[model samples]
Target: MNSSLFAVIMMLAVLIPSGMQAQAPATYYNSAYGKSGKALKTELHEIIKSGYVTKSYDFLYTIYEESDTRPDGKLWDMYSTCTWTHGQKKCGNYSTVCDCYNREHSIPQSWFNERSPMVSDAHHIYPTDGRVNGQRGNDPFGECANGTTLTNGLGRSGSSTFPGYSGRVFEPVDEYKGDFARTYFYFVTRYEDLMSTFSTSSTSFSGNAYPSLNSWSIALFLKWHRQDPVSEKEIVRNNAVYKHQKNRNAFIDHPILAEHIWGTLQGSAWDVTGVETPAELLARVNYNANERSMMVAADLGELSYEVVNISGVRLLSGTLLGGDAVSMGSLKPGVYFFRANADTLKAVKKFIVQ
Candidate 1:
């Protein structure tokens, strides 16, 4: 974003307060506007699924060096308090928690038949203590009452403490609950198209695109997402993952996006501002094939927008007002995103055209 566009954006939408700050460029969230509930979830699904780079399961070890490294160069294993050097200890075999580290599928591979993209996706695969990973044993994440504590004494595995289910469950420490919750959110949304085909044996997922989580899991994850909040560790990891994976954890980038689909913001338009809206005002782009032009329209009062390709390369940018149709007829045929923002159209550097 240039200085002039930033000035236009600030004048269009009200700035959201601290908790739900919007982070991406003006064009990143354009197609998701005026959508809520399932529609919002679908928009998010499309956004996160774009440009995904599929690495082999073995490559997760490489990903952790950047995504989960602690300041002292130790693996940030949430499953145990044990300290570990990045590549020094592989999970050869472990009788104790600190003996070795391995890839722990936060969403266990069995539930999805150990398939391709899902199996290799680094977003849900975490480097964890082998012993604690064994303790989890494919249980759903939840509060456990009188649960068996791990060797490090932070995580627990036991019968349910939460309502609606009494099955065995695993619970991590409070500090990382939000991180795990948001990871689950990204997993379900990104794979939503295939969700209906996934096995629902775990009882956490309903296997549906919208409200994909089971009743109990929905309550549990929402509670976790609200309590833990996004942290600096998550922000750093999000960037690192996108650098390799080509997509983002939208829930981490815009925590309020979760509310629009599953919590408080339901039934409301998905706006970057998160302001209360009285009606369903729509904004969209339609390419006029006859004239070889891109047509953008919005009822968002005065606005600022940028046309960018999937790689974040800017093609065109300017301001628009009212319900008028603005055309870019000279533009060639190609897929482009029409992003709208208030005054926060800062530097969109991920993709820059020379």
Candidate 2:
């Protein structure tokens, strides 16, 4: 073959493969066009259902070592900060915190009677310490308060501390709260049809597609979702799961979809072909600690702003002529939302006060 022709062929080979790799996610998301609310949820369920590769329950031990590994190449055990080994770390008998890492169903299997698909779904199953898993057994996720029973530093299980809940509950550390929230989002969306059959042991889920989460659980999970955002671990695990299951968790790819579905930013119009541009801009708002202010670049001529705590308590509110700043006041350090409202546009952005 001629040298020029051979070079052109080689370039085509590299560019073709690279282009496909880059467009894979967009291609997968294309099926969700013109979808929102329950329609969107159901569409995603169908889109993801096709590529599922079911594995036996025992296979999760090997899978977790790869899918949940941390930055240091160690097993990512959420129940405790232990350096768990791959094959040897299977739980046999554990009486302590870091004894072994085992498969934990973030959504208790008993809720679905240990059925297929949901039982082994990697989205809700995690690699957690066995002892802590036992502590969290069958208890729904919630904040624990009085009558605390277990505290492994990475997790707590006890009587409910959250409002509107009065049952034994399990709460993972703050670092993994968003992880669990996104997983729960995936579970509900992927299995929207089956939700009605699963037992609502906790008030967290409502067993329906639209407004799939209860009021209190929506508040709690939304808070965690905004606070934690998506991390490198989540992205990597998302891709790994896609490789194994042939399906992707849409929320991990598009976090703003959570808000569009059931949280604060619900009812905002979004582009079904891709991620919402307005939500992306809102998420990128800058927080200036030195100025004690938050700002987003938008041309909303005359707008009002409000700073609210995670519990929906209004801390500060005022009007802003375009480009004017809103003071952070003497509010204590914690996660807060900065909401901007105009004639027809409204946006909510989350920022942390250190």
Count of residue pairs whose backbone atoms collide, per candidate: 6, 0
TM for every model, in the order presented, reads 0.70, 0.70
Error of 2 at 265 (Å): 3.4
Which lDDT values do the candidates have, in the order given? 0.72, 0.69
Model 1 deviation from the true structure expressed as Cα RMSD, one decimal place? 15.4
Off by over 4 Å in 1: 1-26, 274-354
Q: Which stretches of candidate 2 lie over 4 Å from their true place?
A: 1-24, 146-152, 272-354
How well is each residue in 1-354 modelled by candidate 1, as lDDT tens digits? Answer: 575654443332221111122234547768988899999999989988877899888888888887887544568888888898988889898898888989989998888889989998888888999999999988989999698986674589999989988889999887678889989999999999988888888658898887888888878898988755555466667766776777778877777778889997798887766322111111133344445444444544665666767544677788777455556564554434455543322111111121
- State the local distance difference test value for candidate 1: 0.72
* RMSD (Å) per prediction: 15.4, 10.9
Query: Which candidate has the top score in TM-score?
Result: 1
